[model samples]
Target: MHVVTTPTGQIGRQVVEGLLRAGEPVRVIVRDPSGLSAEVRERVEVVRGSHRELDACMEAFAGADTLFWVVPPTPRADSVVGYYEDSTRAACRAIGARGVKRVVTVSTAGHGIETNAGHLSASLAKDRMIEETGVSFRALQATAFMENLLWQTEAIRHQGAFFWPQPADRVLPVVATRDIAAKATELLLNASWDGRGGVPVVSPDALTPDGMARVVSEVLERPVGYRQLSLDAYREAMIGHGASEAWAQGLVDMAVAQNDGAYDEHHRTAVPSPTGFRQWCEEVLRPAFLA
Candidate 1:
């Protein structure tokens, strides 16, 4: 049996679909079963509760050989790292108790290079916690997700621009969430690999913010631009959008770390993932913008 957490999320949903398509028996731990698609509801075993709860994890992980883990975000968290530990603490215990053999988790790139990098640091700590359980683990160390730009759809639609704290000229590695899910699905299905390691799921694009803007402009058939926001402005913007002060500050720190080349080491050795920036913009962003 294969178990998935956050089954309704962007990547998790795709992972679940891939597993089902492969004829694997799947189970999912979800806060709301209603969030799952009708097809997913009909197909997989649903353990309705937060994966952070030991009871929920224990129930869902029973008789499961492989597990797909993704820590859901908590934007209002008072302490970013504390929230990650709290969220994964139960699953760590459950993984050992339930005897789930293989584990696949969505994690960030920048494992060794990032310190105090808010969300990135917290994610790495989660990876360590899971590794301590001694289950065969594969950390899908992904770069910035292309889907993250979907959050700026309105800005791109109305203002013909997008914003970020990163420098316009600094090339950043990015990947489509579907590509990440595909990699996870492949690992989950094989069950042949053992031990622990990080898999880099970085795309081939060497695009800076300016380069990304140019791609968007071409795809959208308009003069789209990229604007660099000050760190203070970025933090305040996050807070204004309902994130806690610590969470907002953590985002700022993550941006600072990325700017300082947290993912540089991994990017250097990465075998290019399939999706290109222009391809993603054309397929994903263009439709979202037009909608």
Candidate 2:
């Protein structure tokens, strides 16, 4: 059996779909099965429980061949990666006991310092814990998600410009979550995988924030500008959007690193994801922008 955590999410749902299409016996771990869409619930065997419970997690994952694990976002937390670390520890302990041998985890793109990269910290914690389970594992180290553009929608609507913490010209590798899910699904369904794959599934192409706005303008046939905000401006903007000051600053920090080309690891030119940001924008985002 193949089990997926966070299956209702944008990427997880696709993974589940891919697995089902591949004729794999499917199980999904969800907190509230009743809340799941009828189409999705009908597609798989549901393992209803929270991952925070160690024994519950192990039982839910029992007899599974491979696990698609992801820690969903919690923007309200005080500590940067503490929540992710704790949750992953629980999952690792349970998976360790259950003798499940293969795990595919979502990890951040960079291998930088802890506080400098909170997203990186979350994945690093998971990588450390899961690998020790003696499971043959593949940790997908992916770039900034293209869906992050959704965060700037308000600015795009109100100001005719997209505002962000990073400079408009700083190029960062960004991948659609759809692509991440597809690649991850491929890896998980392959039956045999090399040990500890740190696959940096990046965009076949990279773009700057302002360049993205230009594409948006072209695709939507309306002028949209890009504005790079100061750290203070970013903090206030996040606050305006109902985020805590520290959390807001932490985001600002990520953007700052991006501006410095920190998460821009494009060395694996041989390794490429099939879907790029432009295709994703034209297909998925353009309709939302037009609407």
Candidate 3:
């Protein structure tokens, strides 16, 4: 049986779908079972309670041949570092105790790179720790999610511009979430024991703010422009929106890193997915942009 920690998240849902397609029995770790899709809710057994506690979650993981581990951090958590460190450590400990052989994880590339322990640093730190769990693991290193554009929707409606953190022409690697999901699912379903190490899942193309603007404008037939904010401007804007000072500043700093190529390079050859930016625009972002 396969056990999935986040059966409802963007990538996690796809992983479950992939397993179901193969007619494999699966289990999901859930704090509450009601959120699962009826198909999954009915077919899969739920191991209730938070994964933050090691023993309970490990018990939930027992007897699973493979596990899909994902953590969606809470922005307003009191201690961000401990939240990740503890939760991820718990996952690793459980996987070890349970002797689950194959593990697939979704993680970021730049986080492993030297830099921001303030924010990026802790994520990279924890990712390294998770990799040491001794399971046959594939940690997907990906770029900024294209879905982050959704954060700009209300602004696009009111301002006719995207107030991004990087410079207008700053090219950052951006990949579709569906592609990330697909790649993750492919790894989980294969279970071929390829005996490989970390896998980097990147899109065919890396796009810039201007590049993104061009796509959006062409797709939506609107005058959408890119406006990159200064670090001070970014800090003030985020703090004004109620983010704690440290949280707001760290986010701005990370954006600067992305713009300067601090998070670029160190990628793998593409394993192409059915979707691309334009198709994403035509299908998802276009209607939202038009709306």
Best by lDDT: 1
lDDT of 1 by residue, 192-252 (tens): 8999999999988889999999999999999999999999999999999999999999899
TM-score of each: 0.98, 0.93, 0.89
Q: Which candidate is the best by TM-score?
A: 1
lDDT of 2 by residue, 1-291 (tens): 888988888788889888888888888888988766787688788877877778668877888888889988766767656777777877888787776778998887764535565456556776888888788898887888888887666667778887767777777678889888988898888877757767777877767787888888887677998887898888887778777665676677776666666665552353778886678878877777767
TM-score of 3: 0.89
* Model 1 CA deviation exceeding 4 Å by range: none
Question: Which residue pairs come into collision in candidate 2?
Answer: none
lDDT score, candidate 1:
0.92
Prediction 2 global C-alpha lDDT: 0.77
Q: What tens-digit string does per-residue lDDT give for candidate 3 at 74-161?
A: 6555555555676788888888888887877777666334555345555665677766776787777766777888779888778888
- Clashing residue pairs for model 3: 116-121, 117-121
Question: What order do you get sorting by TM-score, best first?
Answer: 1, 2, 3
lDDT of each: 0.92, 0.77, 0.74
Instruction: TM-score winner between 1 and 3, please give it.
Output: 1
Which scores greater on lDDT, model 1 or model 2? 1
